[model samples]
Target: MKTGKLVIGIFSIVLSVIIGFQSMIAGLGNTLSENGEAGGSGGFILGILMLVAGIVSIVQRSHRGNAPVIMFVIGGLLGLILAGSYSDLYIWSTVSLVFGAIILIFNIRNKKIAQQ
Candidate 1:
């Protein structure tokens, strides 16, 4: 669990950094499309939420069971869904889904553990 959290946390941080960089390069006024359209900041909020969740998981190492792990899985799915446009988003989404699968498998293996 500790290892899984650490890996996911690091990946989340890297994703956040990449998104931040892209936002900076694109400028705050720039929209996802030339029509001045956007996803209404949901993507940005989700990225930050994932980063925080990862950090919390790392800090609360031993407490891993189901809920947090499930959150990671959901985050991964969200990433994949959001990846339709941004390249960095796609990369992170792929990474998250892969790592999330690994973590989910580990969680499933410990059947004796009760879900919180």
Candidate 2:
């Protein structure tokens, strides 16, 4: 697997673990309320979505396809945007930018390898 993909996969796994643990500890409703200022079934659904996305991203890293990588990048970007818009925190946005840059670098490396 590419180094960038591996890093992103590991990060996603870690993020999933953190979010899952938080959900378990605080309950989805409370957690969402704390972070997003909203609560209820939607929060639970969002938590589930995050979990699924994290797992899928990790799994997709090992597969030989650009589509998954692209999706991962897009999802990460979206997450960052949402975080910034909703929470007014720029951390996720910065992280997302770095992650995207790393992925892009690895993609270029892969293309060069293929050409050679």
Candidate 3:
């Protein structure tokens, strides 16, 4: 579980970096035409949320109990952001959501195991 959380945290930070860069450069000629500001601040927030949730899940996997729930919320927000995209951000948003869900489920299972 610790390893899983570490991997997830790193993955989430990658997501944050990617989205942050995309947002910073989104005002370019054609990038904003599709992605625009949709994935700018919103995606950035979700990415940060995922990052935090991932770290929390990892750092407190045994001590804290609600880590997976945090991830579930992040995944839901990512899914929502993906829904209103211009097809260009579908891949990024969907990928983030997938990672968030994976983290969520992994933590949930880990929590259960810890209970036993």
For every model shown, what is its TM-score relative to the native structure? 0.64, 0.52, 0.65
Could you tell me which residue pairs clash in candidate 2? none
Q: What lDDT would candidate 3 get against the real structure?
A: 0.59
Q: What is the lDDT of residue 16 in candidate 2?
A: 47
Q: Global lDDT of each model? A: 0.57, 0.48, 0.59
Over the stretch 5-108, how does candidate 1's per-residue lDDT look in tens digits? Answer: 67776777777666655644443434634545232242464466567656765665565455545555666566556544445555655565565576566556
Question: Residue 68 of candidate 2: its Cα lDDT?
Answer: 39
Candidate 1 clashes between residue pairs 3 or more apart in a chain or in different chains: none
Query: Tens-digit lDDT track for model 2 on 1-116?
Result: 45557667567556545544543444454555666532222223333444454455456564445543454455445544444223322343344445556655666676777789
Which candidate should be chosen as best, given lDDT against the real structure? 3
Model 3 Cα lDDT, one tens digit per residue, 12-43:
66776776566455435335475444545555
Which portions of model 2 show Cα errors greater than 4 Å? 20-64, 84-89
Give the least accurate 10-residue stretch of model 3, judged by summed lDDT: 23-32
**Candidate 3, position 31, lDDT:** 57
> How good is model 3 by TM-score?
0.65
Count of clashing residue pairs in every prediction: 0, 0, 0
